[model samples]
Target: MTKLSLNRRHLLKAAAIGSVALASPAYLRRAHASGGEVNIWTYNNFVPESFKKQFEADTGIKVNVRLVDDQGKQFNLLAAEQPNPTVDIMTVAGHRFLQFIDSDLLAPLDTGRLKNWGNINPTFSESDWSTIKGNKWGAPILSGMEVLSYNTDYVSAEEARTWDTLFSEKYANQTAYIIQDMMSIIMLKMGYDGNMVAYLDKPEEAARIVEEAKQFLIKHKPLVRKYYDGGAEIQQMFVNQDIVLGHSWNGPAAALINDGFPLDMTIPKEGSYGFVYTYNIAKNAPNADNAYIFLDAILSSPEIGAAMTKASGYISTYKDASNHLTDLEKKSTSFTDEELASLQFFRAEANKMKYGLIDPAVEAIKAA
Candidate 1:
């Protein structure tokens, strides 16, 4: 029973801040039949230790968690295991979850086994992101938007609500952007002068538009204090007052405030990137029955959702989790369900491909 700490520095580093590795531990190459224990693989700092203990206490099934360094590695691990895999459940993001489903690496979830399946917000439960062709692949457990986060002492709510604040000369050499998720930066660049909607509406121009966003980033490089890949690095910059505004995911921003920093995250006028984290059952799960038990445990109780949010700094997907959040936690993440679903964002596949090009462009510009 390794107790993993959910600290800012540790979580960001292990979150695979940018990409995934092609290989995983060799021990997981083959599948085995159900044993007394259930093996789960996921990113670190997501589920709290207490929750794992409680789940065991309730079901009497010992849980073994394997930490994944990157979200990309989840698929790589699955692809390596092939027909039979030892992992029972994995935490896959919506985009990667789709790929898992397409590859037949995921099993159709039996909603009848999930007591709280009916309680999930209909918006997520009914969406194609979690369900496809009458089969549900996973349960949406965490949700959040990559919002514009800033130090309140330096930038007020009014000034920080727009994308302009990031590129303004007032904060020249004092702004930072997470280069890891280049897609979000591309969207920020496209919306800089209000050209995002027009650009996205034309998919054929994705390459050209992305190039233009790279050039835009280069143009504002002078204003940027530095480019970062990990959320914790950006959080450290804020704590040291090295940056006033930058690109940040909601969880890390929330973590900052909880640590006593005056940080705030908001959806910019152009909109922010929204994502859903899912718990997927491996197609060749060793303990399929326990997988269902875990999913039901998370969704059926607000306490579980609250614990997840408190540990990961992201908002809960469970509808009833709102009853458990503190006033401060609620204020840190102010996005509504409509806003999360309505944000003009790119799909994970598209975003991943765009970043392939956007990454080198950023490097070249930074060198220049």
Candidate 2:
């Protein structure tokens, strides 16, 4: 598997850029683009610079991107700037798409205009997260799955491909919880049968389920060597040999293996948790025409999708894009049919309630 090369300069550039201070001139200038531009608010480096240039060349519309780390902040900025909003295009995780839809922040999509919409993986296009309330508010653009990632030098592929390994005595104190969010671990403890999002549809039942999920984490606390608050720490721990097996997203796992860390991710037999970042046109975008044109050009073209995947570790939502990716890129970003059957994603609105309930529950568990 060939790994996409990452240079020190790129890493530094990514780390140095943070969210433009809210309401600053830079933020204001970017939030509102001229008629000739399509203002976009997305994660740093989520869109490939090369693709943006190509889109600009094909069409007269100039692409303006603003980097932000927090998806919640996207809504905050939009809400503050409403009635005369600046951002024309917004990209958010699939799980959080509903929040914007519920708040009336997104424009109803005309999928017929997106020529390559059909090329997107059915798993994404058909997902409730992609199409809510009978309207498509966002297009799934990037993907990453929460799979069992471990240092291969320490754990064999067979041993790492099961949820049971996380609780086993063999790797006890050698396992780590790298993800800050507890939803993945909570879902695993729930046996992957209960829908975390179901809490929204059936609150009474979900409330009880939430309690059980928290207790499950407390029970497994002894098995964890450390509970990391971020991905970088988790990667550092794995590199230092502090942990043999831990939970990880596919993108980071791919980067680690490529860095020669002897690490890899496995879709556990018990299943996996994954997420997709979707592209949505703002409800009051100034250049809605250009936004659709840009979306179609980027999301519909396999080559363009491949460029984004290559530039960022995240996978493309369009499945045909896999044809343009190398073996390692496919292995890192794309999942097989069997893996897809086992993967589950949460509903953003329902998950908001879950996060609210789980946060304090986790605190109490850790305190105990």
Candidate 3:
């Protein structure tokens, strides 16, 4: 088979067989704070950790930040908890907001206390995935996009944008695939309509698109060194000359180049996938007022927000803060100015298929 065809098959097989595919975790009991605490569930290095410091300094609400294992699992866990939850707020993808809200795990929000709510960029305030129903249920702070990156030592930026070259038949098994659960984005990049994935994911039309992409990945599977789960590992692999070009988050891609790795990102002339995280209040939050205060306190300060932006490699939702970013970072902020104007956020009703798609893809690979 041609290398590209093999790569497609491998990708499908990996998605079908991979085990990182997470199912929504169920909650058996209500976990609540014992005192004047606002427990938060967020990623290890995102806003929660940085904001926690400022929040405690300002709100005196005694912030308790918990690192959840991962986004998919976190959502499943919250879904299980339902009426009673362990967290006051959980940082998850904005697209998944309604899934949680509809499950009744989130509480209605009051932005009145959030003086800086106006600072949020209009895109997020009404982005394709603002899932609070009629009222705002989640607060958006920072966002980034998936971009193509290449090791300058091996390839040029111009050449990195070509998925065809990256998954050539000659280098099929020598390639690497990302293990993050964003196969939809990959499929989208392969000439399929991701924007219409909501209607397409289950339709026979999508089958042609998916099968085409699947053939591409599986054909290249034998060439892949191994699938990577985190951006850090992916960066390391590139730095070590393990791969020439790959798909990765813009932050780490830029960081590698900023930190002096022979790396650079490809600003797809055609655009790329965009994504964001939202802060959702748990239904049974013990410190609702404090959470609101903390949300406002952190998001309002453009300086602090910009600092978080620099540290996290995401574009701040606050336009004022984004303007303050260095010209270089602004051009490279989770996106090229061109990409920000072009790429669409990866949005489809995040449902069981959203999570199920991962394992099924991995299973498909194993079967192959």
Candidate 4:
């Protein structure tokens, strides 16, 4: 795979620049002759600089991107903007779209307007997350998952194949994971059938499973060197040899492997969680025509999809995006058909209970 030089610092710097751009009123007012500007709210590095410049050059639609890392913060900002939102486009996770839909913050996507809509992989576009109640609400763009990542120099492929490796006595004090993710995966490991959402309506059962996971985490707390926060922190831990085994997002793990680190990640035998990130038009977008133009430009081109995958270390939902990837990049980021079949995607309708149960359980585990 071609090594991408971007690290967390570079991403943060980009986000800082985007934030400054969003804060400037004059920047938002600038218009082009061919098409008006499209204001987007998305994660840093989700839309690479190269793609943005090329899109602008091709369409004459100036792209104004505002970066927000936290999904909760993004939702609140969009909600606060009300019926007249400054953002024309925004990125949201598949499982989290229901709340936005419930609040009527998203506009129904008219797929007929997007000629390249067929380029999207059915795994995403056909899923319940995007096609809600017979209406298309978002365009699936990229996907990411939590996986067991380990340094190959110190950990064997055999050991990395299961979630149990994280708690092995031999690797104690050399393991790390983000708390909430670890807890959720633990619930999966405990025979929830990879369907935690099934318990959302059954509050008593949900609480029981969450409590069990919380206890398990508390027992294993001593094995973990740290409950890291972001992708960058886990990547740094691997680089410094502070962790031999970690629960990490596939994106960060892929970045380390591509950069020549002796690291590998796997979807453990017990299974893992996956979430799709999507692009959606904000309700009442001022430049709706420009928004559709921007979406078409990205969806139709495999080159843009490949660039997005490389820039973010996430899998592109564009079906042909892989054609542009290096063999090594494909191996690191793209999943095999069997692997894809085995994944349990997060459910959109269950966020309320999922977080209500998992969040407090995680806090209690941390306190323990």
What TM-score do all the candidates reach, one by one?
Answer: 0.77, 0.76, 0.78, 0.85
**Per-model C-alpha RMSD:** 8.4, 7.1, 10.2, 5.8
Task: Report the backbone clash tally of model 3.
Answer: 46
Clashes of each: 1, 1, 46, 0
lDDT of 4 by residue, 275-355 (tens): 988899999999999998888777866766776777667889998888877787788896666556657877766777778
Model 2 weakest 10-residue run by lDDT: 18-27
Give the Cα error of residue 270 in candidate 2, in Å: 2.5
Winner on TM-score between 1 and 2 is 1
How well does candidate 2 score on lDDT at residue 22?
15
What ordering of candidates by lDDT runs from best to worst?
4, 2, 1, 3
Pairwise lDDT winner, candidates 2 and 3 = 2
Residue 228, candidate 2: Cα error in Å is 5.2
On lDDT, the candidate that comes out on top is: 4
lDDT digits (tens) for residues 1-368 of candidate 3: 11112232332233223212121111101213223667788753455344455455444468777776456678788878766677788887776665677677788767776777787888887665774457877788778777777766666666666555556654443446564443555566665565445543465555555556556566667666667666556756665566777777776666455444566776566566777877878888767766775676666656655655555566677768765566665655644466567577766564444444444665575456
Q: List the global CA lDDT of all models.
A: 0.69, 0.70, 0.62, 0.80
Off by over 4 Å in 2: 1-35, 57-62, 112-123, 126-128, 167-181, 192-194, 197-204, 219-243, 258-260, 334-341, 362-368
lDDT of 4 at 7: 57
- The 10-residue segment of model 3 with minimum total lDDT is 20-29
Backbone clash pairs for candidate 1 read 251-313
**lDDT tens readout by residue for model 2, 195-248:** 465447777776677777767777778888987654555666776677888887
